[model samples]
Each structure stands twice: as structure tokens, then as C-alpha cells.
Target: MRTSGRRIVFLVGLQGVAWLLPAGTIIQQEEREPGTSKVKAQATISIDAGKLRMEQEKPGEGKSVMIFDQSKQVVWMIEPAKNSYMELTAAQVQQMGGQMQQAMKQMEAELANMPPEQRKMVEQMMKQRMPAPQAEKEVTVREKGQGEKVGPYTCIHYEVLTSGKLTREVWTAPMDQTHLGGAEFKTFQALGEFFGKLSGQAPKGTWELSGMNQMQGFPVRVLEYEGPRATSEWMLVKAEQRSLDASLFTLPAGLKKSSMEGMSRE
Candidate 1:
């Protein structure tokens, strides 16, 4: 789950073209729970044109790796401990979206039969997970006319609003500074769209969601809120541009790929 620190040194040879070679970028991020100063998880993200890999480690959850290959239009979720991987295609994600919608309907039906007090409690809890499907609302982003120095980069601050309520705040650095090109940014957006559909969750102004399109840069720090309470914070820790091998995006030979059905059964 780690990106190699090996650097591809540039040589000013006769052609002087070695310095022009494309380089992959690596970013480190730390996550914290709401109202807590202690970090709860850490993630390393590697970005190359048309591809991305993220490795996240959280307390008690071990490490998980996710790779998105734009060329194949598939995402691979790898479990190193099991030496296995799962591929999620657009069709599979769409099918899962339908399944989630059906489950939401079932939950709503059951909620109607619960005691009024219990229903209120449950509904309050569900707000943080999934918004009610019927409550359609557009997410909005606004520039706050402020900036922050996060890590080595200076970032513009912005706010995300859902139905006129503050839902998230973000600080972003320009794509040039983040070493993100058009293809890489597009792939990143696609990942957001896929996860949004798979989870049946409304967009909350993240870099991967609709609102981020208005933000004009890559997110460096993001703070998510539930009503008036800060729920989570993700801040960039480091970014490095270096050469990455194509094999980094490929699955290991001889490992079995698990199906969605097999995953659910487990």
C-alpha cells in the first residue's frame, strides 16, 4: 500500500529530453473525526494520467487499496491480506445503485411501523448516512474570498451548501501546483461519480462531486459537516512528483478476482 520513494533522475543529455518525461504524483492525507484533534486515518494517493491509486489505513480497519484505470473504465479494490482483488465496472456499480435504492425503500416502509420516538431517533441517525430520497436538492459552491496555507501550497477557500445549509468547506490549490492534468482530473471526477451512484448518497461538494466543478482546482483540505457539527476533516500532508511504473496499476498475477455476488455472500 505504499508508493516507492525511488526517484527518476533527469539527465541533461545530448537530446535534453529526459527531463520532459511524464511523472506521476503522490499525495498524502490525514483524516480526523468530528471535533477531535487526533488523526483517525491516513491515505496515500498516486495520480498518473488516466489512472489513480489510493491506499488508506484506518484504526482497526487495516489498509485498503483502490485503483482506478480510466482506460479500462474499471476500479479495482485490492485486499492484500487475502491476496485477492475485486473489479467494479460501470454496469456492476449501476446494478448496485438499484439495489441500494430498493433497500432505501424497504427502510422507509419499516420506519413507518416503528414507534414515533424510535422513528425520530433513527431518522436523525440516517441523516448522516443517506438523505431521504424524495428530498431533491441542488448542491451549491461559493468562494469565501479567503485562502489558507496548507502544507507547502496556498489554497483558496470555498464553501458547499445543500438546500441553503452549510454542508462542507474546502481549501484548494491550483491544478498546476497539484501536478494534475486534464486527463487525471477527469479520471478523478469519474471516480467520484461512481462512488456517489454506488452509495446512493447525495453529493456534498467534494472534489469528486458536482459542486467541485465550480471550485477550479484540486482540494487540499476538506471539512465535512452535519448540520452545525463538524463531522470529518481531510488535509493534505505531502505531494511528490516522480516516475511511476505501469505495473503499479496492474493486479498481481495469479490472484483471484472476486465478484460482487461473492462479496455480498461473504
Candidate 2:
């Protein structure tokens, strides 16, 4: 689904704030193993008013390309822009996963120590600060199709019912070429059940689905369902699996250092 420009700005701001926190403070974390890559894949997303098309390719080490189209015009492109030495090994990815698990446990312990009223207040604050839900509840899976000859893998298709009752479908294949027919079916069923509970309404908390994609290249996930308010269709665009150049993950260069100094003064 194509997101409106306003929604893009809002999400970018939200992500910026999220990145300000230490990695250990993240609510959810997934480790991407090094050297994992997907050859190619396509995703067609539909929502209330529009649809988005995505094509991705990982051609070499530390390089990948993502092309997004909405309403038949190329809207966005993601390419390798810079380089850094912060690459991770497979073992390190596993360790990071463990660290994330431990961090979540610690956070739960701390939250448990809070008084009842304080915890309630905290929950309320979190809900109030939450972003708009990306996927509308009207979304439905109409028909699913699969293929077996795609590199020792199979593709799972999901039919999405838009708010206007229009049906659109998307096909996903594993980046690692692993057959995920059973798992994909289960995931779709579970997602449908969860959406059914909302009664075509948005909720008041973030909903996310993260894991590997069809090609087994890199970890991919969805962070569109944010709360009761529906997000723009554009937010549903799928990202590809590939090594993200370290520079893209870091703060941009050439900004005046005085901004930090001024914040300290305040």
C-alpha cells in the first residue's frame, strides 16, 4: 500500500526517536546473520485507497537495491551509498539475539517492580505516544497461491481485503529458498484471527511481525500496525533482505557539533 507523504514524515520522525535509544532499550530485536542474502522477490501490497509494488535484489556483498512503485510511478529507491567496517558475523548475530532476550527479561523485571498505579500511568503514556496503525482491519486474505519450482522453495500468496472491500493479493518466497508453505499458512491464519478481534478498528498499541522472508537473504518484518488510527498505505511497503551499509544506520555526517552542545546547555 502506498503511504501518503504526511505519514512518511510522521514515521520518519518516530523512527528517529527510536534510534536515539540504546540498542538494549529497544522493545524488540532480531539478529540478521552475516552473509545471508536473497536473490530477488516481489511484494504487492494493498490497502484502503491504493497499492504498492516492491522489487528487491541483492547482487553482491554489502549491496542491494530496493525499488518501490505506487500508482505505477517509481516512488523510492534504496541503494548502497556508503561503507563501514561494522559488519557482523553469524556467531555475533546469535549473541545479539541472546542479548536482546536478556534485555527483554530485565525490562520485564523492572516493570514488575513498579507500583500498580505507576504501571497504569506508564501504560497510558505509552498508548498516548503510540503511532497510527499501518494496516486497516478491513484487510482480508481472499485466495492464496503457491509454486514449488522456485529454487527448491515455494511461494505463499495472501489476498488482502481493503477497507473498500476490494481484494488484493501478495506473494512471498523465502530468501533462503526454504519451503515455508506450512509456516506461511499458519502465519496468515494467525494474522487473520488477530485482525478479526479488532472489528475493523485500530487498536492502541504497536503490532509487528518480523522474521526471515522467502529468499532467506536477511531478516524482514512489518511494523505497520501501530494503534487504533490507521496509517497511510505507503507505510506497508516491504523492505528487502541484504546487508545494510553501516553508514545508512549511523547519524549523518557534516552536521554542526554545536547542536549537541546546545542540547546540553538546555
Candidate 3:
């Protein structure tokens, strides 16, 4: 769950390179429930080129890792507990979404032609299969001025509201923590853009990280809420830029890889 700080000195040499941080740049986030303030999960993220790897650690449960490679246009979910890994390409994910839409349309047409009694049975069946309509979503990110310090970084506050309810409250701090700047920081901005594209995108209403561009720094602390109660808080704990082996970005050896369906099997 921890990225070695010992390797960080090597990353300093990567300044002004095409890749902003070194390959092993590790960013850690820890989550804790609101009222109880109990730790729930810990996540470590490493990014290089078009590849992003997230390793999540839970107290009792086994570890899980997810890799999203923009160059390959694919996502992989890995469960070390089961020794299994699954892959989903961008095309495949979009195709699955398309199939669901087609099925819905076909069901609507059939219902339109059915008799009253038959329609009622079909409607009941549809209700069981179809998900309920989601509430109309509204996403807005508003700056809330200065925020309290988190660790060594001073933060700026911002609120992400959904349908007029507060969803995420963020404390952002400047990238100076990385000791990267000038041309290197500019390269990092470009890298962020590429990462955004690989991670699907923000829909019209979903505010998922929508206001990042407006902020001057990375979000160091994020508090998520369920209605008025705080669900959990995520904050950046440690960041280390270090040399990394390219092999880490690719699939680890001795693991079976398949589509999502295979995820449950292995």
C-alpha cells in the first residue's frame, strides 16, 4: 500500500522530460468514514505515459489493482485474492452500452403492439429488468476560498454540488510539493488532458472531478458526503516520484486475463 520514498531521488533527473514525473511517481490516497473517522480503504496511484495503475488496499479484504492504458485503449481490473484479471477495451465498453440501448428500444416497440393483458405482464417483467429513471443531475464547482492545511500543504477549498446538494468538498494545494515546475509542469498539464480522455468523460450532469481545470493545484483532500452525512474523506498522504520498471505497466506474469465475465470465474 506504500510507494517507497527511497526511490524518489532518481525522479529528480526526469525534469523537462516528455513525461512529467518519473515512471514510479506514486500518489497515495487514504479514505475514512465521516462521523466515526475510521479508516476504510487506502489507494496508491502511479501514472506514466498513457498508463495509470491504481492499487487499493482494504484492512481485511485482499488487495485489488486496476490499470487503465490509454495507448492500448483498455482497462484492466485485477484481484490478487482470486488471482484473476479482466480486460475491457474502450470499443468493447461502448459496444456493451450500445447493446443495452438497443434492447430497450426493442422492448418499447413490443410493448406498443401488445394487447392490454399482455402489456401488463410485459410491463411487470420490464420493471424487474429495467433500472429506475435517475434523477436529473446538475454539477457545479464553486470556489470557497482558503481551506485548512492538510499535512505540509496549505489548501484552497472548493465545493462540488449535485442537484443543489453538496457532494464533494475539496482542499487543493499547489503542485510545488512535487518540486516540478516550469516546462515540466506544463508537460504534466498535457499529460492530465490525455488521462482525462482515457477515463471516459464527464457527462452533462455528473460533476465527477469537473472543476479540476479551474483549480491551481491538485486536490489534496476530498470529503465525500451522502446527503448531509459525510460518507468518507480522501486525502493525498504521500507523493514520490521515482524510477520505475516498464514491466510494471504491463500485465504481471502468471495471471489469466479475459473479459469482465471471466472476472467472476477466476
Q: Which structure among the candidates has the greatest TM-score?
A: 1
Please, what's the RMSD in Å of model 2? 21.3
Residue 135 in model 2: lDDT: 38
Cα lDDT of candidate 2 equals 0.33
| TM per prediction | 0.79, 0.28, 0.69
How many pairs of residues in model 1 come into backbone collision? 0
Each candidate's lDDT (Cα)? Answer: 0.76, 0.33, 0.66
User: How are the candidates ranked when ordered by TM-score, highest leading?
Assistant: 1, 3, 2
**Quick one: best lDDT, which candidate?**
1
Q: Once superposed on the true structure, which residue ranges of model 3 sit more than 4 Å away at CA?
A: 1-24, 35-37, 100-136, 178-208, 264-266
Check candidate 1 and list the clashing pairs.
Answer: none
Better of 2 and 3 by lDDT: 3
Q: How accurate is candidate 3 locally (lDDT)?
A: 0.66
Going through the candidates in the order shown, the clash numbers are: 0, 20, 0
Give the alpha carbon lDDT tens digit for every residue of 232-258 in model 2: 221122322222233332323433322
Clashing pairs in 3: none
RMSD of each: 7.2, 21.3, 8.6
Which stretches in model 1 have alpha-carbon errors above 4 Å?
1-15, 33-37, 102-129, 132-135, 199-210, 261-266
Q: 58 in model 1: Cα distance from truth in Å?
A: 1.5
